[model samples]
Target: MAGRGDHTTVPGQFPAQGLRAVLGGWSGAGTKPRNDDAISGRIPETAYEMQVKGAIACIADGISTGLNSDKAAQISVVQFARDYYSAPESWPVRDCAGRLLNSLNSWLHAQNRSGSPDAEGMVTTFTAAIARSTTLHIVHIGDTRCQRLRAGRLVPLTEDHSARFMGGSESLTRALGAEADIRVDYAQETMAEGDLYILTTDGVHDTLGEAGMRDRLAGLPQESREDLEAASRALCQAALEAGSSDNVSCMLLKILALPSETLPEAHRRLTAQVIPPAMKPGNRIDGWEVLEVMHSSTRSNVYLVRRAGEDGRFVLKAPSQNFAENLQYLEGFTLEQWVGRRITNSQVMKIRPHEDSRFLYYIADFVEGETLRDWMKAHPKPSIAEIIPVLASLISAVRVFHRLGMVHRDLKPENVIIAEDGTAKIIDFGSVQVSGFRDLERGDKEELPEGSLNYIAPEVLTGQGAQPLSDLFSVAAITWEMLAGRVPFDLEERTALPSRPADWAAGDFAALRPDLPPATGEVLSRALAFSPKDRPEVMSEFLGEMRKLQGRAGTRPVFVPLLQRGSRGFWRGWALAATAVAAALAVALVALLP
Candidate 1:
């Protein structure tokens, strides 16, 4: 008494034209009285979502021994596909899927614990495949499986979690509600245009086997969605006809195309606007009038602007025409706007949306403040007490970027703005590195480091990519300059940039400021280590050490003798003493003569 339960086909429609695939799913009960299997999937309607979160296909199989196994299977598959698309687009696909699966497992376990006694609780096996960009990300638990067929070769992508007992009996070693805590397997595979992926439950895979499934899939057309649907139904039917006594399910996804692996492709897909030419005062574009040319450089231009019929002012930034054809620079410019719009911290500048604009530029909130460079110039050789508050604010700002999976690769005095109330806001997103963007990139080409030479981390200079530790290094360099009136490394004095990590050495902070506690120098030294591994494991650790130094500054003595302080202090002290001795000798000679 075999019967089909549910069947669906998610149409292959990519309006913006990227990552196209065709999906079909079918489920049925072979001989069991009730079918406790579920299948679900989603293809986003928007191209932005496709590029960021991608499409998902999931299947779950409930244990027949459980009373509410059907409910468990349905809930797991449906909830996972729905919730995964709702996650932040900035998160890496692996992180988003891992977190959702963990949460889903916990909720299923809780339902089992709260169920009525005298009946087995809900339990099921789960497996999912996410097609993002040019790769397939797989997450799995229990015996539910995902496999790929490429170039006529069928490859298993997931391992079953069931174990055979001594007497030939089998039991699941892992499932969604089998335990309070779950450990799921994760893997990735590079996808090709003609690749076909299959997802199945043990009912289908164990009964038909890979050989039988391949036999059923042989001669299936690649482009016809109807043919893929027929193949999915055939696989389940073949499994049941082969003497399967349980629920059978099968899902098919065929990759028809992948996104282009180039910066120009990304630019075209992201925006259709043209880069605005160099702007000056009185220039108007997209209803915003440029009141002043704030700053202009070969890379970009910043202007103070005001929109028509608005009293508030804004800062508009545009990429320079010099790099109009530079795809990498244009991509970074677009990413800067994307990052700004997503972040909502007071310490980070906010991007105002202008969806109707025809030019490539972003408008940001204008904060009235002086650059940290100007502040440093005004308070040359600022005391440790004076620097602690500013440093704390700067660190707070940086933590926001880190929490959002970003690294501000360039952190220097000029990039920070200090308000009259001592609030520090980090600016300049040109060099920020985003984990999400890295996941989307296809190539692994190395490029020169992206920050001012003195402030960039030593590891980055040597071709190591920027990380949170790299940002910490830049912050420490800025802090060192504020306290000692000089950078930690004299990068300007070098004939050329350091080609190796060993060539870059941090200058001696203790030698310049002996009045501060020795621990202060130790903290800065650790932050500016030549290797990222040698630095504090996280930004919080570096901040903790800085706070400790700040706490000790009150009790610590700063009245060291001038000779031990520094060269300038020692020479000034000597000059004052010599002048006093000369005055004393003149008085003595005058009295003796009189």
Candidate 2:
């Protein structure tokens, strides 16, 4: 075997610190007149597609007994590379592979002829893999094998679809073109950096048992790593030297990196972005012209901007030029855009798609509307009938974020904008907390909660992390403020709301609104429970109780159930009744004894 040290091949680079990789493949006819094994691999160009679909590698081995087996092998390998890339980027890897292979199988099955062993058809063994995120997805048919060489051993990642034949020979019982509707065996395995994936034809694998293969892989040259082409050539050469008379083929892929954004890398990318140049009205930056300063704050400045040649009106939020070094604020600004791009709900604010701008800012649809806080001022002392739908919409919008593993920590009425058409759009995601994104913070100490203190949950003030329950607590607070003109608790600075339901007695909501129902107070009390465990764990549970208000009774009931009135009263009643029964039973027992 020639050493790869003598040759140099350029490696592939991808996003996320250039997810680098090396690939090598080799094929040849051992003793056969013509080779019938084919292989191909691909890496997408864009970061989004690469992260979503990942890279693909495929191998196919044609049946020796079938005519045009060489064509079968070549076509399967070639078409898969083309079709897999052409599939929808939004589809999951499994769905894309299945849909593409199903069409390929249909085409091959259409070419079938005789049902004999030595039949003329385009039947072939097929196996392929996709490496994405931190996983490898493998889909196989027939006998071409996919295996991983890790921890000094070769582990098979596929199973052959062959049955016992006469004299210990094996015949393929399942293949790509064997049936009209094919079943593609699929599985996924977690992957690590430096992991090696090897695809082989039966000729290469059958000649070398698992132990011999492990030895061969271990013997691979390590001095000049990333020599996949040389390793593959060497692997195929070994199988030929081992007395194999069939076509030999091998493909190798060495994982160097997985696509992911680390905290340091994210900081670098963000800091590299251009800070918005200070400009008054009529200044143009990257095809957008500033019209007027919409608003200015210590953190950022919002401007009403216009596209150079388009009629679209947009709101551009630029970080204040002075705060460029504030990584905490920059992180929030970046995350606001990230969340905006991913979530598409009627009640959630939508960011307008824009060309890559050099400034540290993003564009959003200019909603000419008033904040919900302003609306509350106009509709002071709003009735419960008028408040349920709006509150429901708010909770429903928050649920979308939760479904995507996000928490809207700052969900106060001030962040919610109410359009003239009565549509409520939740805006300002800079304070939104993401469970996954937090993992990338690299031990960066969490700053104080940036949420509005008046509507924040009690736990947030006590230095606890915000959760879904805490998020709902804010919504319930807004609900109370909307109906009774104030939240269940006082909103003074440095005053944290009680943490448990038992401690919520200080907030007698009905005292302010004499007409308020006890049921409404109970739900509000449960939602704003001091301990998150006592609060409704899911938004649906809180919404379910609110839904009961829309039943035959237009409002919540004031009647307290016997069981729920108070623990003390129920236990006391039971004790009194038990004493009377005991006295009567004692007199009866005395009469019986006499």
Candidate 3:
């Protein structure tokens, strides 16, 4: 097998400045050994860049023990990086993963169908580590592991997909080429001097638990001539002693310390990295002027923009450095773009991006209206006549997503913008969950979905799987607040809001305003159901129920529950004095009285 000695470092890790990393791994020359480990690299080409750069290394363990497992693992790691770097800069993480998986699946399946037993049931497990500057992004699957050693203790930084504690039926839960697409577990950790990272095949991990591994690493002194190499040897010896039977491979990494003067320079260097020049003003990016910045967010920046070729205008969204650096955020942003494009209506904002590339900025039709929160505050207690129409519009707006088989996981008043025409436009598909977007077989839930904590559905707050019903629950909460003049959960005396499964059931929107129309009240009760299945199955059902209650009264606005005009009471003595004064005035004005 080729080693790190031959492969280059990743583009982002070059120029060898602060936090230099050295990765060296060896395969034991034991009997029945199969060199199932695959590694890749990229080093700086320019002398100046290399002077201030670091290095990146990745190790993949092909399940050589299984039929053609070695080949399967080898192809996955190699193709992943190749496909990743070759793709356009705008490729979203999910799209990238999906594309890579498709390429791999096609290759693996074709190889399997070629009538060779080795290709028939072929599968492999792998773990990969990407180190750059001062951070490590670890992506892995199966029992192959990545461990972090800080202050002489080895920490398992990567979760074992097959670990029984994490619901791996009996062993490792996931493996490469196990199915059509692979699910990679990703995590990011800061790299510091004196930190040691270890990536290994199951052979090494099976031999030592955390305590046992710590003992072996503890004996080695840092900076010793043989420290790094010896540590790998000790692990192998321990595994052998523990009765390991498979080939043991290990990639040991040591983060070399940096000089004090270099730390500040590195900070300046990283921060000074400039964005590429923007397109010329007249140059259109998806028909929107790349206007000056409006706002910046962790994932992306919002720009106040106008349509280039048309009379329309919108807010153009560009991925932030934070989103661009990480694959996950890029994927989520891509999904938002996808959902927005697929479902275009007056109720939903029109989302347009540069043709085919995920890297391009997107234009969303801007809504010129106040958020529901702002509207409600200006008119403290609005009657049903004033509120029901807004609710109807919101429900009508959200109904489009349901028809598209999508759920707006985050539906709050803040996300609902009431347009000047009274059209309550529902925006922010950023948190939407479409049925096609999920992979149920692996049970991987969407991470940190965008939503307001105050308005999230009870089921969602507890980390339950997001579904259509949860969206309904949130919609109900918003509607309830519309009619009741207050949030259902606000009056409760709790240190913090309940974050448990039971708390969702405890909320009663009806209790906040019992005087609400029976139909409106019933809809709220059903929508805020504890179990997601019990809520309205779709937006149409909720809209139908709302329309029924709205029709019982006239189309005109009414402030029935919100306010009323009262007559002023007259004082008895004041009335008598006023009468006497009126009688005297009446004598003088007799002609006027006649």
Candidate 4:
């Protein structure tokens, strides 16, 4: 522990997401002749940088094989700290850190290959901890350690990358620059205020055994910043006293504060934004001229709009005036734009938020093309060659939503635009099911399912939550319509499907599309399975089967025969029953007339 007179101030501060962190560390060579270990960290002073880049701390240990081993250690830790912050703010912590480490590893490997005199091969063990937005991201390699000290209880957070060989010599199994390509280990954990993290080189941990270290880490009160530093210094010194042979290094990080508002509370604030007035072609709002009213309905209005002095065209979408006060509608509208902006793809619409415009409106690219619905109208029998690639792009877009724990429950030709370049872009996120947002949106109950019945999965009629397979089913329906010009079974607009599974199976799509290759139509038919479990488990499987159908005319797919359609005459029985009911209704009407 530090003496009362030794009140060492921290080097810097990094604040973000309504939270504050106090970082401290101490290092030494211990009994070793010279130190070959390094510790470094960077905390951004600006909120934008802090929220995007967050705070990063790392430790590196050099192998004794090279004479200038310390240089490798120093460069690894210091460069990681610097380069991590300089990365683009739009990237997530995991992506930014992973990419930088990969680049750094390649550079270090190149240095080793150069074979220069007096130059130690640039290879070292690396471990980094990133604190960002109520979460902690861990990027690790080699045998260094990272742990969380929460509620005075030590929580081990990393697995050491070391193995014992046949000769009983322990060696690092993974380390940056150890080979031409490195596999970085990554992990994540949610964070809270009063949380503390401890980073240590193997020298410190190997000497201070588990029980000894656990006892020392327990009961670290938030007495003062010096106390935290004192704990770190004591841990390092204790390892030296225990006869550690290598250089010892340790870093301590404390979460002094965390954001008070829940995610739901922050989301509601977005809904409180001002609603825009009704728009017209000649009217200008927020400095953007409305060129044309593209589409409008009970839900929202979309307009072709542009800002003066801007070279590119844009589309503006706003909630319907009547639904301005509807909280669910507002949340859906906000979420549509939110999801649009987060996703990165040319096939997915890009939503640009207007910082100055308080009105509830968002601008996106004015893509030049027709909706897949309209395009299908023009090309009813689109060649398999044309539709396959376009549909593949659309499936890829849906996969992005799946990766983010969301489901596009309502997928149809109307919601997809076939761009002039033939790329497919999905739009209208009103029916996107965000699995992560359920807790935040629990208060806003949906009275009914929010999708067009023509494309909705049969299981949805049984009041089941929308699953990714449900979206795949909708995708199959749209593909079917493009080729066959109709759904498997005729449906009234937005009408409820038969509740029974038996009735659903009776709609044999094979009977109507006999011209299509049995294998091709067979694969698409799997997507229309009444039970999600019976469908392709993933979109990739669906796409793979579709790809296999290309250029193979003789391959007969596993055909599930139209069950009980011949002798039993299911449709004929249904028609007869319907006619009988109609006659009874007529007789009752005549009696009433008399």
Candidate 5:
């Protein structure tokens, strides 16, 4: 049997229109007694879902030796695609697919072990391609393969996990339900216009070969859905005629168009509501009454407000009317709402729904706390013990963003709120860098570094782009300030800011906090390194070191042997000794001559 279809995002649905593509698939029993091959694909209907999850296409081929191989293949393809979409949107594509595949494999493995007599067990090869924004994410296992057709050339994207014996017979070394623990191959590629992703089982590709497949695809009209479907069927048919007996399946996803701004459509959606003018307390707009102005700035205004009949207090953040015409700023302001709505964590501020509002603003849960800057002021010289808990909470919160493929580009003391109970909540999404959103953007626009000079990563200043390591740099700076009562680098004192990564240097932590252990300074120094490569790769590693530092207490100053000290200290001591010896030898020589 052969099957095919297509999916396209509804027009004019999102402020920034999302990924667009065409999907088609075909499967056949070939010369086999029964088809154990299955193919499935999904493209979300809503713009939000389309942007977050994008689309997924899967193909699975069951082992002929298994009693329920057909059922296993069907479950693998259908359930894998269904479960992928059901995963949390906040998760990165790799995380979503990896976690789902692991769980699915475990369940299938358990089912196989519990089967009755006469059941040989269930096993199948699986491969899937996920297209989100402008990236293609691939996950593969066993002999099923994923390939890309770009610029009229076929490119293999996955390697077969099979082993061949002396007589040329082959068997899968890895497959779903074949083992208790599964190792999946995952990779990603930048998607381009007119790219066609192909997924096929061994029955099709092993027979047709890459050359044959490429020639067939080259002959088809790439853009037309009908032609794409016809090509899928044709590939399976050709494979069957060329010889051998096994189930044949193929799936094709063509990139119809990459995301580009439909300006009129985007402008209409983004500017649906007028930017509200500045207002003081007692002002009313959009059902919510302003109680007090929480913050005001040239970029945005944050107001503390409450609904007419509700006792709950909320914070309403509105972009400055001055930027009403600044589409980029407006888009970022809108993205704040999008990000806040998707992230559901107590450590991160939550954006509440206000469907009836008529103004261009978003309401979030009002956190009762002082800014971390103020917290630092109250404890100018806090011990490592006092700072560890706060750092722990902050690290946990930042990891949440990292896991979601987001970098809080503007992490600073003012951006973190320390509640009365000591919990921390990260705020201000104005400068967040989201991986998915980056793909939606139309062009590269040069912009200044987002965070404060003292806290922003050195690499970001040099246009290396915001990353998880950048956030780590900011956190380390904050921690240094908490202990030393000053930023690691007095950025304000410099005549000119560092324009390159090599020019940036962190102040000596040992000089500032000599009373603490040497390891303490070493830890902070590494985290505050000018090169991100010099820092810990993950937050957990950095946090683990901090935790170790917390257990050590302030020790009385002790004299150290020159050899035991740093290279600089050891070399300086040797130079002083040599100077004394030369002076003594010169005096002795003068006395002997006289």
Candidate 6:
């Protein structure tokens, strides 16, 4: 039978009647608590929608080995619940889990691409439960355990994704935010009146085995709130005593019935707003005072700003008025908002605080340095040894995005700014596209074109396709320019820009920059190849190959701009035509006299 706490509702309180749940989870690093991750939020009330019969309960544990495992687990649970609650009620419980996972995948891909410093490749194990009447539906991944405690017996509801369970794959074979495809285990069962459901991370289960768990949980008196709390504490203490050095957390949910005074209050809570408000230029929102407009594009407006009640300043970005007015533009804006708000990566910009606003706004630590374009213009391209770290960091950021199943369609010298400390930041997400996730539930072929014309992947230019490798090609092009100090493609006035797949496929960078190292040039060649399949399929491998050329380094070569004096033949002839024109006019007049 299903436990009573297996109901689904939005996060926070409910409007009517249902179950009560408490959550606890813990993480261990063997000798020290590296990451203790767990979360439990009850919809304080209950409701009866067509597809949903009871409330929803969720528990998540991030695989602690990845960076910021604790944070990953916490955000996954909180954000998933938050999104499920706000979602339209058309989907069944399983469908809801699928959609939520899709959204999480997209966000994780973006976060990975951004190369979140704290948790770039972080993965988590979690289980989410939604109850309809007496039925409980669960979606789970990783080793985090989920079980029902009823009639003084413990019943396991989810399986572990550990190495032992997967034929000695020492690492987690499945986890949230770890890959593009998450393997979720789902099941359903009926609930009992006095049932209790518990979810916990490995730290709690590793120390308190099945028998140990039953002993503590069964002894608790259900009638007394204090006894329940004490029993939960005793279980945690027992894990610590058993030499579990991880952060331990657990959740306990009790299933009961409708209370007369609770229903009305629960109903009112459902309509409350959770998103923050939009901030405009020159307006102070969340203590970041907007100062001067930095730049504006079709998508967002960047501003030079100062922090409130602080000495430091930062850069703020908000979606343009045009973008905010259109629902399509909201995708880019909301993505930035979601990525900026949830990630705690130093490499990523921080989300600006807001109140009940929906548009995107974020504050980036202002880099006091020039862009790669400006730097290359002022000084010769630095040696590969000097360039590796910068390139590596940038590559890592892109990897972060790729892991989340996203492609940043644009990457150029102008988009990468190098701070005084030599840290490279790749910005501008206007052209990013999700591979398997779409807000409108539309087909991939139907999505509109989104990316810069110059740096666009060949397939994207032809409206043929886009993938993670496409973005890698663009990154290679930018890296080439960073070292070569000139774009690989330079078309004369007589020729049109290489806007076609044929142009990109046949064009040779070696012919343009003969001075570039042959090995480096070949790497760039394959990356910018006309077909997406010809490029590096994965970012990590591409980066690994690029690293080989970094320290081998070459001397800076003199660069002739595409528009040099010798190349401006047509303009020079036009500039010297005045005397010739007069002489021609005189001869014509003399001929007319004859």
Q: With candidate 2 superimposed using the best TM-score fit, by how many Å does residue 377's alpha carbon deviate from the native?
A: 2.0
In order, the Cα lDDT scores of the candidates are 0.82, 0.75, 0.63, 0.75, 0.81, 0.62
Per-residue alpha-carbon lDDT of model 6 for 131-180, expressed as tens digits?
55456677888887778887888989988886654465346678877777
In model 5, which residue pairs have backbone atoms overlapping below 3 Å? none
Q: Mind giving the per-residue lDDT tens digits that candidate 1 earns over 158-223?
A: 999989888787889999988988899999988998899999988888998898888889897756
Q: How much lDDT does candidate 6 score?
A: 0.62
RMSD of 5: 10.3
Clashes of each: 0, 3, 19, 0, 0, 45
Worst 10 residues of 1 by lDDT: 1-10
User: How high is the lDDT of residue 402 in model 2?
Assistant: 78
Model 4: per-residue Cα lDDT over 1-594, one tens digit each: 111111222445444556577676777777677677788876677875665456677888888676666777777887888887665444456666788889888887777777875554667898888887677889999998998877657787899999999989789898877788989999999898888888888888888866677777676544344675678778888888888887788777778776565546755675667777778998888898999999988878889998888788899998888886566667677678878887777777888767666788899987788998898888877656657887898898788777766788778888898888778888777767766444334434562346577788876656677778988988888888887788765555535568776666525545655555666667877888889999999999998887776665544355667764566677789889999999999999999994
Residue-by-residue lDDT tens digits, candidate 5, 367-405: 999999999999987878889889999998898888888
Tens digits of per-residue lDDT, candidate 2, 274-373, equal 8886667898888788999878877778888998677778888888877787777788887788788877877787886677766677888787799888
Of candidates 6 and 1, the better by lDDT: 1
Per-residue lDDT value at 421 in model 1: 92
TM-scores, all candidates, are 0.88, 0.62, 0.45, 0.72, 0.81, 0.48
lDDT of candidate 4 at residue 12, scale 0 to 100: 50
Clashing pairs in 4: none
CA error at residue 73 for candidate 4, angstroms = 3.4
- If both were scored by TM-score, which would come out higher, candidate 2 or candidate 4? 4
How many clashes would you count in candidate 3? 19
- The local lDDT score (0 to 100) that residue 125 gets in candidate 4 is 90
lDDT tens readout by residue for model 3, 469-532? 7777777777777777776565235567676545655354445544445456667777777777
List runs of model 3 lying over 4 Å from the truth.
1-34, 40-58, 65-67, 79-118, 129-143, 153-193, 202-249, 252-311, 314-364, 367-474, 481-520, 526-594
